[model samples]
Target: MGQGQQEQVATSLAGAVSEEISASLAPVDAELERRYPGDPGTRQPVHTVYVPGDAFAADTIRSWGDQALAALDEHAPNAASFAAVLGLSDELAEPVHSRVRAKLEHEPIEDLRVDFEDGYGPRPDAEEDETAARAARLIAEAFKNGTAAPYMGIRMKCMESAVRDRGIRTLDIFLTGLMEAGPLPDGLVLTLPKVTYPEQVGAMVRLLEAFEKARGLEPGRIGFEIQIETSQSILATDGTATVARMIQAAEGRATGLHYGTFDYSACLGVSAAYQASDHPAADHAKAIMQVAAAGTGVRVSDGSTNVLPVGPTAKVHDAWRLHYGLTRRALARAYYQGWDMHPRHIPTRYAAVFAFYREGFAQAAARLARYANRTGGDVMDEPATAKALSGYLLRGLDCGALDIAEVARLSGLTRADLESFATPRRGDLTASGK
Candidate 1:
């Protein structure tokens, strides 16, 4: 083509591109106006809670109740004490309920888990005729009397073959009965144990779907909390992929991932002499779960700190509590909520959560503030500066150390500035003190 013809074509192409860019900017401007009109500088705080589900038991209903009350009075004074209780059948429920009530009279509590059954393996033949019926009756009674705790929940058995052989059937019957008896409780978290693969999760999802349909409940009303107990679930050679697959398979059905530190350590042949929660095996297992759950909204919880001291002596017990605090903090830093198996451990639980967030957020804010001061331009140009600023923002957001707006304000940046720094060619920040 002649030079004149080629130049004309290039000019037309550039005009078309400009028009496309203009069209795209129009909606972006409108969205900015709708979401942040005259409020470009406004920042919002990120509210995040590190949920520690109860792995602790008071030994008896009375003691459990008393301890729960005392703990609430002590550590979670403003917050309600939450408990997860277990019962094999309806006959067992009343006895358990009566015990919990006596303790709560002194101290208020929130949350309860009426375990449908205990232990693993096939459900007993008696389970069908008696256990299921009795559990349903007791739950109905609890509902009618309004004596049941405010935050009530039910823990269905895990998805082992033995459970499928019996417990699954029992669960079907029990869930149906519970639905008919009253409104489904505040929430339902299927406690799946020994879940080795995605197919297993898929199985649970299917079952939950069917139950919801039968009960005329929302299709995804129920959620799951998977227990990463077995070595096979974490080790690649032993079907670790299955665990990752299972999580993906459950998709919207999963709420959280919990590490079974003791069980995982045992599966790895770690000596009984070692502390399960602190063992290297346990760390690796938790790291695996953390990596798997990277972008998934599902929360991850660490296993309980099983050591229970006789009494609270800050001098003697301080080391124990600190160690526990550090472990919980590490998990929290890794973005996993941890479990507190005993009430005395609550102090450590809250302490770790507070320290991790406070320290992390402050440090990130300081660093981002420094970067902001160092760079004056609306668009950052230095490679190292841009990378550090971008990384600090992302890590802060991931750990709940800083929200997007806070990151922007502290870094003297806009959302577009941070996003541009996140582009592949720019890369992540370099390690400090290297």
Candidate 2:
């Protein structure tokens, strides 16, 4: 072919490929929208703290938060230096300091995940099943007594070949036991890890549907977050991205996409010594996840910084530095949520999050207001910008770094406006896990 003809042919092929993908997606897209009709909105938790299912207790997070604060006092150089690192003003520092003490005395855990996967490990099948049942009972009891964490869920092992049936059985036992105790608690969901095929997601949705039918619960009641841990999870057999396909397979039950740091890095052939949250491979996966889930209302969370803040023998400073840096990077990339592996990370998580939200908030809020009013000539306030700006403050409000009153004043938005921008939160921290 001539040069121009060759170029035209290449363009035709590209357009054909795009058209094929779109046509294949059309039905799934339509179904997803009809099932999840009005805006999917946002449900961004700053962090997910995973604990072994067998060890779960309603008050465990608060205990861990308290312990973290005590360690700070017994090991740190001075209160001021710690305050500086947390970016706490003297006034803010006092409250954070007191909040830690109070959180320990009260509710410490914000978002907790009971893990039957790596965190819990593979025990005897019967023993694991029993533990799942027991955890379910504990969670239901806490809900009945109005003591459950605001956001709580279970992380089962991968639903893929090797452990598929085991994961399903554990999930079935847990949900069955929990529902038997009482009504499903608000904000309960499942976390499906290492999803390498769309069929795995479809199977999970079908399983949840069965649970609802058996328990007389609503369909789509048990939503889930799909963990993108392997390269194959992102790459479909047809040479297209599968994030959308997995969410589509959920049939309106997929709530978020969570990246698995170490596993994803390993999948990319990274050595154990170099695998971290910000590894190139991990970031690439997260970026794809973010793009795939954007506008779909499927929240995207960066994986945890595995380096726990276990101390006395370890410098908390090093842990804090790593956590803070990773957090800031995630926040900057518009990924508001992440995972926390240690209780000592509670303070650092909040500190990093609050600092992120507080920074550029004033300027962003002002710009948002001007854009809405059509006074900021250079600023074109689009849906994405509005979501980002509002999310930043909503996170602050959730963390108590910014209150409704402050948000209204700074953003020129009303109480209802701010409230409407985000999901219903279990109120602010009370028992300070300082």
Candidate 3:
């Protein structure tokens, strides 16, 4: 009787109802697609080295590499000694130490920014114009000769009333110089510092638009990083999240949001002693930035540590310990990139980065392999987790923290396969993967 009486239960809403709902929400869907396009699936550098515009030269990259190696030779001459200073495990000592040295020799600075802001200070108008033009010419030569950092650019002055026109003039001179030198280098970057309002981001977009038009380049071709220096950059007077608005105002031209440790801390009235990237104030600002940039194809970068690795061996070691610990902490928190101020800081920066990836290499690769192969393990992983794992391995490879052959052997996946997994599909942005 039950079998005869049961009715088919597959009939409910008509097919047109589903279509109608989708039609009604079409604009919302478009907004979602436009606003949250996820990671761009490109190589993000491990650290940005800021050299004053006046100090930057054709041989600056090699000079930094040499200085880093000399520091290593003097302070921690051997792998064992260097490992002891940074408290590396016995297994990681040799590999990490050797990799650090090799990285210094081969590719010391991943991203180099010639500072025209705080680091460069105020220069006479004619002097700055000449320097900006010279910077562009030298950078062009470096790239042509294959001696340039993988990424190179300038950090122009802020949008504040005091320096707005000056910043615009410098950026114009720099980009114009590059255009005259040749088609701009593909690795070119620009930074806008001390953004206090989203309107400033709009201003930057307009500025870039003008440059592109004048140079007969495609629209929206130039992108820049928005530096979060003042407290107003994080929160508005009305308590709204200004950073989120800034990203929207960028109109797809924002490549990154970089924290400015000292300026931000000082803006909040934090004493000089407590001004650091890890300070509570800095954490709050960066956390907001991380959220704001999560699915918007914009990366977040931590600021530099003021502690330089200099002086006697003992003092150098102390500075190394501090820098290493801070770098490791940032990596753990998923802030994959930071600023490296000095050539000597390069050693500890690479050491910490290598050790972080190397220590977790096995687990990440295994999890990714299992997820890729659809074989269950004690820890189950979803597609997003697979993306994260592949991304981790890729970053390791990019920064010399892990090698492709070893990663392939361990994960049973090729570089192409990892790239497929690491690249995000539209409408998903659960992890930064940078």
Candidate 4:
């Protein structure tokens, strides 16, 4: 067709019809944009390491790294031994093993949460207040000194009637200390645990708003994770999904929905022996949470395991296998993040993540390269698939599972290029028909 003919063929609908349709759907479009803005396109940590409030010290992060390395040294002792325990393929054994050790030695704790909740139990009001303030100061200093995790904050007590006032006071003290120390760190993260109702979420929103007003900061500057520990948080008594309501009630301050393994399991009366992240009840709850949080800029995190890797070499190896398998399963399901309770869990966590990303890195990079260049291959690609591919590579890079140089070498795309594809606007995705 001639250029003029092609120009004339643009958009079959009449101008007036198009305008009317757009005008009629304006509200719907606005709502869609408001509710589903896709991911926030930030770096999501692979795991959150929870340290008890009183136990968290200036050197806590480094201690965890050292302990993780010690665990590896005493148990696996070498790359081959570690790989054999996790059944890593020969191709991945060396790279994955070396990477895991390096990660442990360097960025061992991506996300650190000083737990003022179950981990702290019930401390006296004065003691709790002091501890919270101390935690704030330490976290602020750590971030300022460049020793903080990529994300660091506290998991405050739940909003239940019994602990509501205390939780509020503790959060206030912590935030106040942070402000006093310095402007809150960009990596600061807060978690509201055991959220059983949407109103609880609203309360958190109000609290953050008040803090912002008091601190003279911008409105909506604070966001917190809602810990889903109760069955009611997943399925309301009235037959609605309470977790969904919780997200809406946050008024965009909810950053995550973290499943609470033991608490959630016990809430449903699941036997202790049967309680696990892969349990049917746990999976059901997380599935609902995932659907509800999809495209809302809120991430979902799986809960932790109670099994600690502290025993004979054989027993530790068994625990490592269990943790590694669970991590792999969660990765395959696209969860990407979970909880690591003990320092010992770090090795397996990194191993599973590294393997998961490295095993498929070549294919994902090649596919994305093809999609970006519009080179047809054995498999036809769509924009959504391209988005997923880019996002996968981005996540791998974020958590140290994949390096930028290697990624660029294989994908022929820079980090910035990957980000562009990973975080395209909804309109952009539709307009760029691959």
Measured against the true structure, the TM-scores of the candidates, in listed sequence, are 0.58, 0.83, 0.96, 0.97
Model 1 stretches astray by more than 4 angstroms: 1-152, 236-240, 311-323, 358-434
Total colliding residue pairs, candidate 3? 0
Tens-digit lDDT track of model 2 for 1-434: 66666443334366789889999999987765565343355445678889998788767766777777776676553547666655566755654555445554565667788999988887999899888998888888877887777788799988868888999999999888877887788868689998988898999998988989988887778999999998998877788888878877887788889998888888889999889988888877888887777656678888888787775534677777788888888888888888888877777777666666665567867876775576765766554455556666766777655567766787789755755543322121112232
Tens digits of per-residue lDDT, candidate 1, 61-140, equal: 23444664565454334322221111113433333333333334532223344454343223456744355555555555
Give the per-residue Cα lDDT of candidate 1 at 218. Answer: 81
CA RMSD for every model? Answer: 13.0, 10.3, 3.2, 1.9
In candidate 1, the residue pairs with backbone N, CA or C atoms under 3 Å apart (3 or more residues apart, or in different chains) clash, namely: 56-341, 90-134, 90-135, 197-242, 198-245, 198-246
* Candidate 2 wrongly placed segments (more than 4 Å): 1-39, 76-79, 84-107, 312-314, 377-380, 419-434
- Alpha-carbon shift of residue 71 in model 4 (angstroms): 0.9
Q: lDDT for each of the candidates? A: 0.52, 0.76, 0.92, 0.93
- Tens digits of per-residue lDDT for model 4, 403-422: 99999998899999998998
lDDT of 3 by residue, 61-126 (tens): 999999999999999999999999999999999999999999999999999999999899999999
From the highest TM-score down, the ranking of the candidates is 4, 3, 2, 1
> Global lDDT for candidate 4?
0.93
User: On a 0 to 100 scale, what is the lDDT of residue 111 in model 4?
Assistant: 97
lDDT, model 1, position 431: 39
Candidate 1: 10-residue stretch with minimal lDDT: 39-48
